[model samples]
Target: MSASKMKILISGAGIAGPCLAYWLARTHLNAAVTVMERSPTPRVTGQSIDIRGPAIEIMKRMNLEEAVRSRNTTEEGTIILNASGKPFAHFEGGDKGGDTFTAEYEILRADLVGLFLDATESLSNVKYLYGDSIKSLDQTEKTVKVTFAGGSSDTFDLVVAADGGISKTRDMILDEHITKNCYNFLGQYIAFFSIPSRPTDPKMWQWYNRPNGLCVMLRPHRNPATVGAYLCITTPARGQQDPAVEAALDEGVEAQKRILHEYLGNLGWETKRVLEGMDSAEDFYMSRAAQVKLPKWTNGRALVLGDAAHATFGVGTTLAIESAYILAGELSKIQSSEDIPRALERFEEVYRPLYTKSEGLPPFFPQFTFPQTSWVLWIRDSLLWFISKTKLYKLLPADEGSGLELPSYGWVDIHRKDE
Candidate 1:
């Protein structure tokens, strides 16, 4: 097998898949890259996420920084409020130790994904097959045969599962026990939806914490008439036995409305207001927070990267994009298909440690994020106040991309739409 004849199939065109496709083609790796997406089109719904660290460097290298920066949420700052909607502490969204509230680059997940799509739409070597997914994968010593949900089959030299934390392809390669162990659900549930904003709603992130382990947040979007609502609450073990949201999550917006109404209908501080149009909101998403801890990232011809292999807490996008960059760079160096396995190993060895370290949670992280008692709220708010007042937040680095050096991979002219 030669470099020009290599075929790579990637699942999930959300972020990592598209970014991987761009880099793979941009590096002139000579491999045909095809992204199979389960959805018909690019998802236009998701809360904002930061593109910090080395991931930002990749975007700049691709000449996508200005496009991404143009879509910044422009969030002013965060206001942590009490149960009664009274402000307890307000801080500018700047670097404050590891507790940095905002990064230099912040874009809504949908917008960022769109940026990737636009960036790669013109690349002749990259292909996208939407509205379909890999149903089963049967691999041999030389090639892997993939059967799609639409009853199509294809063979590829390598398959990358960027499908996400709950990867179905990972299950096809590994067992149920291994999958369970790899995913450590933080026993918490968060739901996001958009509600019509009030004229008085300020263009800032507003958070309200109650004495019942409930944290509600409102982030003003670029659309002034609508605001993004986020609700976080501690759930039971693993969130597998979710009698509350299991059917709701499967059913539709109406089911979500009924479940959320039963749990958060009576809360204060715009909680009820946000849930008013829940039945009509199409972007309602609720799921358990999880961290992926795979024993190994690759098995035979299949490789799992990004959220599928890492993604602890809520910050996994940047790491995912970075993983794509490294993996593509590694593959670009290979002259023959025989070296793919070793390249995959190098990708895991170089990134597994950094991603693993980032999965560590602070002491009583859930309690600090959403306190259930008055004392906890007081203590948490007081600590935030002290951190802000004393300027101790400056001790921490701004973004994790500090020392990461990006490889050029001889990718000088990779179809970048001019500056």
Candidate 2:
């Protein structure tokens, strides 16, 4: 039960899991952390994400700021385009660091994951298992016994599910009722992929909204040869699940692509080119926008963090980084493995409020943002043009900090030169 001898297993080698491992391995606890990812190799495909508020501080603490900045997507700004592919409104990028649609620290999700993995590579006690997952878990008061999909078994002092919002590992440990009640769907389905870039591609992020609740976004990437593309469709009502979307989610990639094509193929302004790129894209990801609202983050020796615990849209990456740091910090305060439950409780108590503050979307939100009629779209466009012309967006407050006073855990410095 000693701190040095403590063993922790983390599910999902995405942003949160590897980040948690990085901290746990470097903390005073010196816990041996094992990260299990279901994918055969590290996932190198995902939409772009940003780091804001306290997460930027945490990145500095982990000595990853320079490395992260080097991989920036280099998007100059955001441009809202009309159906004719002409810009009607423009918001400059966050180069000077005020609130803007494009953040200063914008990086692809895969690049961030790679950075975290590279950061933890030299840590002797941290291990990564690819093509493996937790088939089942048995938790007692002191430890958790895990059965892996690869037919291996191990006992760990603690188990953390940093998998994702739709975490299979979380389902294994939490009750069905608790799991069911935690989901708050925003009734929006999104598909992300990479499209071959052309000379005409704009350096700024181009957002095109069409009638019938359809939208297409194309953002510049660090690699000019390709661009990140997003296709979105909003349901009629909030919290309503579309049967077709559910079926597409249940089925494989082809079905998901079909659903997107059925909804957005006819819409012009790069729709045809985007769909063509999607057809050849090796990294097409689709998911519904849902928030996971868990009453408690820990159940016995098992705990969930990041999207597995609190998944929201706007500040997901920031929350993931902040939660991992807080969880590791809490564990560092404990003297023995027996104190883990208390530590886990403290982690939620301190972190949950910060998460809830960023949880909900504004009233109508994405629904209202995507107009369904021509008149409504005209109004939206006119309003955006007015706002842009007047520079009204500057009145919005900047994301200064997380408001939660971050605790000093006296973590050991694990700085390494980027390879």
Candidate 3:
């Protein structure tokens, strides 16, 4: 089969799937690209996310940099506050391409996904399917046959899983042992929701750390009337999972709320208002922080992309965009369906080193940040205050961009001319 006529099926339309679809349609104009999302409709609710490093360049190549910047969350900077709501430390926002706690390209996840979807909407060969997911996948030497949850089956020349870390589609094809051992959970649980903005709320991100490893954060949103709230708790040991937290995760949102309240409800700095907002917040989401490191990203004609392949915490969005671009660029060089596997292998070879280097957290991460006692909290606060006052944060290394050289696949440039 001609590469341009190849049929590709991509699972999970969140970030990576739609992005890959857009680039595939552009690179091979006649290729049939289908993106399937499990949600019944487009999810427009998510916490703010940062786009740093190569992702900013990817946005420019796609002619989406200005559009993305127009939707910035408008977070001025970050402020570490004491229990009394007094600021103890402050960090200013960095430039658009600089790496900082609050990135210059900070925007909500839903907004970025919307931009990707919009970019692909005009391509006749790209299609989107909502409210369904893959039930199973069977891969042959030439193609992958996929069975859907809605009692339907289809065959495609290539199948890519761009689903998130806890990917069910990845489980259908990868070995059980690989699936079990790939996730490195960082003994932390976090919840994000939107609350009505108050007159007292500052434009900067307000972070309060309490005893017993509890932390609360309130950040500004693009919409001035609403603020984003985050609640995080750290367990005693790294990689340890709490039974109650696990049970709550399996249960519904109310159970999750109860667990969060049990841990952070009494902690003073704006806890009451945040919990009250949580009760009525429709977009509350909680998850365990984890990084996925797979031994191999491809098996036969099937492959996993983005978080399903390598899910780092802070740089996940950037990595997803960069990998999608590289995968599409490599596939564009192929002449026939027989070349798909080689293209997939080349992608892993070129990108795996970067992903491996980006897969770790800073030294003494969650434990050091979340103190369990008042003395520790004071010590941490004092250290932060000293750092901020001394302007030592400026000396820290900035995550400018991935050192990898991007390949030019000679694909058509679909960048908007009017921009």
Worst 10 residues of 1 by lDDT: 410-419
Better of 1 and 3 by TM-score: 3
- Lowest summed lDDT window (length 10), candidate 2: 410-419
Ranking by lDDT: 2, 3, 1
Model 3, span 1-419: residue lDDT tens = 46247899999888899899878866754678889999999888788888877777777878888998899998978899998988989887756313558877889999999999999866777888999999999888888999999999999999999989988888776778767789888888889999999988988988899887789999998889999999998886669888998999999799999998888878897999999999999899999988898888888788899898888888889889988988998888887899999989999888787677677788767877888789988999999899888877767556555454576777775533243
Q: For candidate 1, lDDT tens digit of each residue in 148-204? A: 999989999899998988888888866576676787777677788788888888767
Task: Identify the candidate with maximal lDDT.
Answer: 2
Candidate 2 residue-wise lDDT, 141-248, digit = tens: 888999999999999999999889988887887877777778788888889999899998988989999887799999999998999999998876778778987899
Task: Give residue 99's error in model 1 in angstroms.
Answer: 5.6
TM per prediction: 0.92, 0.94, 0.95
Report lDDT (CA) for all predictions. 0.78, 0.86, 0.85
Model 1 pairs whose backbones collide:
213-372
